[model samples]
Target: MVTPTESIKWKRRPLSTMGQTYKALNFEESVLCSPTQYFKRYIPDDLFTSIAAYTIIYALQQGKSSFNLPMYWDTSLKVNVFWENISRDRFLELRTNLHLVNNLEKPPENKDKFYKFRPVYTAIRKRCSDLPIEENVCVDEGIIPFTAKFTAKQCVRGNQVHGESMSSCCVESVLLFQVLKSQGINAVGTVRQNRFGKNLPFSDDKTIMKQTRGYCEEITSADEITMCKWLDNRPIVLCSNFVGKGSVDEVELWNKKHHKYVKVERSEIVRKYNHAMGGVDLFDQLISSYIVFIRSRKWSCV
Candidate 1:
């Protein structure tokens, strides 16, 4: 019998079945829009299924974009039928291994640096590009709650699932800023949470608080790095600890004890980014005005 490692290797072996079919049909690469003619390869059934499933899910959640893994995966589907023939086990295994569904955080080394959710971000920036230079183009992160979906872990003190929280500025802050830059505007990201490491000085009263603290901190660090990259070119990017949503009650009575978080996102942005002329105009602009442009109409993040 083939071992798991052997099976994995066998599944990954590149097959040229798709090339033959394409050649027979005289299909043009430009018509398909793939970068290379060799893009039409027959990936394994299991691999194909994960790509197809995640492509759809990513498009739904993030939007379509250039760096989206889902688009790459899903594009291969029309040329091949491997995804349709895969067994359930093979499909699940492929999904879990590829880090598509996020059952857990990806290892630091494995995370792709260039994998930006392009489509959603492009839409947001394009919408705000026509606005004046001092308009507020706020940026935020939307974390998924996979743990919350699992009931078994609910009993754990720190395992509660909070509703969607949008930090005023996150590490993704820098990437978002770059998107704005492409559209003739400036932006930035920041965070201040401590969720990755162990034995931190965070309060234990609320597990979500502690986790969020670390998470935010990491985001802050990432934003700082990104901000430094654009310091010389676009010195007006903003960073802040503003959060848009918070949970007042936990799912269970014991879990719920009246906990909440508030954000001063507008003020924080003015303090960090320098274009608003002493923070007054910027703050008023955000508070008194609304940019009605659609930020991400397409599925760039898919």
Candidate 2:
């Protein structure tokens, strides 16, 4: 079996067609945006700091919260970090019964883990819950690198284009949903389009999302009929880049059309990137744009 850790180590995992265009965040920005409290509860400070460093970079590259690649990459690496510090036997024990580890003993000093990262997850979840909830959830898709290498034979559904391993952009979507679900928000991940005919990691049919896991309501733009069900009950939370200030109005129009409003959250690590590259003007146009994007949307939590 391909352990999660090994999966993250392979940078080629997420089809490297783009030459690292997604720059990482800088140190100051990274330090400023601390990890959620859940991480502090279990992961040791130093180790957690390292993990946070990588995760912040990963999150920035992902552009927003996600699952497809970044989610797996984060989990896999933490798993590896844990295994490397502790023996395989102990690792298996914890993997089998994570709760016990949380309640009974301290994590192995050398190993790092995110399995019971309730604090971080909780923080994110708590923030999401505070947001308005609705019945009809909106689902969309965006593309990001897989951070791994897979050949044409491995994609399972899409055309096997060389170099890039076509994978679902679920990391950001799922992360948002995970947080929402924790707060009793019934949302779902729906596929807007499938340029390539590949099965989603959690889906069985390319035509519709396979509702197999998680509590959030799942739908795909392809399933227009089913999607309407969420119109009144689940408010839409579309995941995309901060196109500009106009995006907020666009979301409002969308809400008015469906009797629900939309909330847009921009997740870019330019500040982090600038810090990583040691750039000043830490308060330059990029940061200002990000701030303006957040303020315009009234996304107070950001």
Candidate 3:
């Protein structure tokens, strides 16, 4: 049944409160016997060979002879080996004819800009997706970062999304949850306040703050999506289909006012979310730590 988010009454509990202890699946079954087997998951040997053959053939077509090497090469008495047994001119000749897809069998350029790069792109995406999907999938902001200035970013305004901005990326969580529900996969993720949908009542930040630390509340949409707001150092909202505010537990949180760590309440939803999303939080931490801090007025300065 297609239930609207507004039609479902706000419930303070989970859709399923079954006391199932969390079990994390190990990688033993997904593991390959050897390094070669691991490597084949993304790039199979046959696919690699086909790519090499097509690329080489295209290079031959670009220059029937290696005489057209760039003037930058200087064509001096020095022998600059471009790639063992291949010279600058020969490499240029090969590069000019390089084809990820066979040049003869490629589709129209307008149909797909990825025609030449499709082979490698499809291989990795398809192979990785072939792995088993976990039930408690931790959904995070899946936006890839790009800070480089480019012509495409400017040209695509109002046409399609090219780069992700903080506001733009955070604004679409509600719809993301709904789509994941249709796939029959469970999801738990932190959602922006703006994405809470409509007609749903939630206490304002001031009201929530007035309550004791760890005081929590939740509401389930008519469609079974649950949103929980919990207080610790600050109020955080977690949206889920698999869990919500259940039995409360205490966790040590730094009390900035007191300058000490104190026990704060954490419910099942918060605990479940933190546990399931530990890897994602770690990944975010790693990437943020290494981000290039270049000062640029343009958003595309990646």
Candidate 4:
């Protein structure tokens, strides 16, 4: 049997035709294509193909030091001529008018915050449902930077980001976890210390490190869910239904006082968490690096 880690190695098949690419892009075509009395604004028939071409061109072209819309249209720069094919006004019009959900009715209670994104979210979930998931899947929270004021916006600290932001911790995340579980996929994720309601057996008399170590030992040994917790500057709780207690590993940490590398013991859970929780972070890093620095007030467009 193939191990979970080894299952990551898979072949990629090329999309053979324009129809395949269109299908991939238009996940909600069935719903969006059919114009209802309430939701009369259906997507333009050729918009998906146009958007795909536009995105490909945008990805290929390099931007100026201060990336802006004008740079692409400047004839002096070495830019793709594709921009000339589609007028800027037409592009803006399509972007402004793109509707996912019916704007005619009030969104259902408690979901007004994400109502604008609901259609795209549904499309994404549909796409995920069709794909074959790996044996081991990991879940983690991510932040989409939005400086604008919104009801569901969250504020995260210790990064370049500041002010209000939207978070990915929602019903969708729970649904994804459930879907993966039902498919017999092993899932793991980091949880906030305060959010984890379990009572730790540690006492006030014990040091933080000792308490954390004790908790890790207790959970790894006895937890029915195979859940575990560990400390790395702060507490990190994780749940893994398939992974059992694993052997300990050690790492060399630099001791500033002694001016030498000191060996520190690390739990198997910590190693696993580090390996599994980085997928979202890695994706964020890649996208942020090549981001087209266009200013848009619309959160959905950003």
Among these predictions, the greatest lDDT belongs to 3
Q: Compared with the true structure, what per-residue lDDT tens digits does model 4 show for residues 23-135? A: 12323334434344323233333444544544444433433122134333445554566466654554554454544444445544645566755655555555567655443
Q: Please, what is the whole-model Cα lDDT of each candidate in the order they appear? A: 0.32, 0.31, 0.66, 0.46
TM-score of each model, paired residue for residue:
0.19, 0.20, 0.68, 0.54
lDDT of 2 by residue, 1-302 (tens): 11221121211111111112233333232344355654553444655554445554444444634322311223455777654455554433323322311322445563434434445554555655654543232332222223243232223248432222223234332334334434543332322423212342322232222331111222222211111111222322222121101111111223445576554332122122222322324424444455321112111322
- Model 1, residue 197: distance off in Å is 16
lDDT ranking of the models: 3, 4, 1, 2
lDDT of 1 by residue, 13-66 (tens): 111111111112333335554434323232224544655566555544454332
Model 1 regions more than 4 Å off: 1-134, 141-159, 162-173, 192-302
Instruction: Give the per-residue lDDT of model 3 (tens digit) for 216-298.
Output: 88887666778888887678888876677877888998888999999988988888888777767887898678765333424
lDDT, residue 109, model 3 = 52
Let me know the TM-score candidate 4 reaches against the reference structure: 0.54
Task: Give the runs in model 3 whose Cα sits over 4 Å from its true position.
Answer: 4-40, 57-98, 103-115, 130-136, 139-184, 285-302
Preferred candidate (lDDT higher): 1 or 4? 4
Residue 208 of model 1 has an lDDT of 35
Cα displacement (angstroms), candidate 4, residue 288, comes to: 3.9
Worst-scoring 10-residue span by lDDT in model 2: 242-251
